[model samples]
Target chain A: MDNSEDTERIASVLNGDISSFEPLIAKYQPRVFATVRRYARREDEIEDIVQEIFIKAFRKLATFRGEAPFEHWLMRLAVRTCYDFLRRHQRNRETNLSQLTDAQNEWLERFHVSDTADSGDAVAARELVELLLDKLSPSSKMVITLMEIEGKSVKEIAEIMGWTLSLVKVRAFRSRAQMRKHLAQLLKECPVTVEPIKTS
Target chain B: MNTDKLWNKLVDEVRKTPSGHSVPHDFEKRIMDRLNSTDAHAKSGDSSKIRSLDLLWSNLVNLARQATPNDRVPFAFEKRIMACIDVPLEVVDGLTLWSRAT
Candidate 1:
């Protein structure tokens, strides 16, 4: 269904008609899960986080004054939920960064750079990307995942992260720089393609 | 490379990064099941008192508007109210008895 229809349906659900909410869940679940998976470690945890986000959204539906698009609001909620999950998990104990071996690091480094490479190069690149992402700070990784990978605009990201426009831009820029530096180092070590593409 | 172009390339690369893990096939169903159960639980627990109060307040306001002047008295009208209140029931009964005797 279109956004307008979804809004109307959500409004109906908020007014006590429960069945109207199913379409909304079906429509936005993939995006929500994708956002959650960027930060969450376990598959079960990702599912739980997504469920929590949707449940929160449904419960707080009354507070949604339509000031923003429904999808934008939902995205904001999803990002916040992921952030909360990360923070909660971090408080429990230490993360084992030393567990990454040379082979795993190489695989992850390749994954990030080759993710955008030709279809033949995708698999190897993906492995590298995953590894590199694992090394990043959750905040940095999240910023990149939402603004870069998800293609959400700066304004939308600011809303999602509860950050100022300038802050979002700054974080995005920093995150991109970090990823580039890491990928560049990986590229230097492995030298995936000898000849660099000429840029004007 | 110019920072702008470099940034774009980095973003492009990140976007292309494949999540090796596939989302579970029943992901939506699981989410919906949880949402439905939670929603049902919430509705069952929520009180209808607010709705009832709103209806009651609305009716009261409408009734106040329809009420005659006699139904609404200002605090300054106490003298007139006291004068009316002074008639004892025995006096009233005795006056009625005298009127009947006459």
Candidate 2:
């Protein structure tokens, strides 16, 4: 019944006071949502992934030793969940030029053809960046998202993914190369205007 | 082609992630509802599994009841089962439909 603190909330939840889980979810929902903002494609998908993370946390609550702050443990769980989510979606799907919105295609064309000026809308450019980033292999996507977007340190990523420091470094390098390669291919092949489908 | 410049540009732009996105307002209620529904589903699943087990047990009992020596065309059934491996049929007639469940 105590709704003031996370520790008491965790204790209450673990004690079968199922209603206490509401506070934990309320307190950490933002951070959990933060973990997948860049990685998840749509708003509903982000919510679904966040929901799954909380569900998993609820199921695995008994295993949560109080050795670390609950936030740290939750973030680690969040990271692992996002990594698993990316792995599940690692199927090879082609990223055609048509997938890009008209604005994104224009931005890509201008960025490639013109000078290195700031495109002003960092948001849109970032979205376009993710469009290409999503086409990479699962491991590559995880490495890049963990290293670049989330700004997690190499050691932290290593700990989270259970990979050696060197392995993490290698994966990050290869992932960046993969992203660059895809971007290069996209830039070379992008037509000025996408052709509309013609009906027979 | 060297795409390092483009990649770096994207990196710089994306680094400052905006803080406008917020967790949905009814997120807590939604999660509680989900947990309750999951518990309900698990309970229903357990009950259904028990019911199905009972049904299967009754099915087996019925099957055993009909397993009497005279209840089956044993020779015909044996030949039919063995015929798949090229064994010769016992040439028994008048027992082609020796099923009990019907």
Q: Candidate 1 on A6-104: residue-level lDDT in tens?
A: 779878987777667666776777677666655764676776676677778777888888877799888878888887776677545443433445654
For residues B16-99, write the lDDT of model 2, one tens digit per residue: 456564445476699999999999999977665444333322322233223221111122322322223233337755554454
- Angstrom error at residue A46, model 1: 1.2
lDDT of 2 by residue, A40-83 (tens): 66676676676677777877889888877788878888878887
Note the Cα lDDT for every prediction shown: 0.60, 0.63
Candidate 1's displacement at residue A189, Å, is 9.0
TM-score per prediction, in order, is: 0.51, 0.57
Q: Candidate 2 clashing pairs?
A: none
Q: Ten consecutive residues with minimal summed lDDT in candidate 2 chain A?
A: A191-200
> DockQ of candidates 1 onward, in order?
0.01, 0.01
Among these predictions, the greatest TM-score belongs to 2
| Stretches > 4 Å off in candidate 2 | A1-4, A112-119, A192-200, B1-102
Docking tier of model 2: it is incorrect
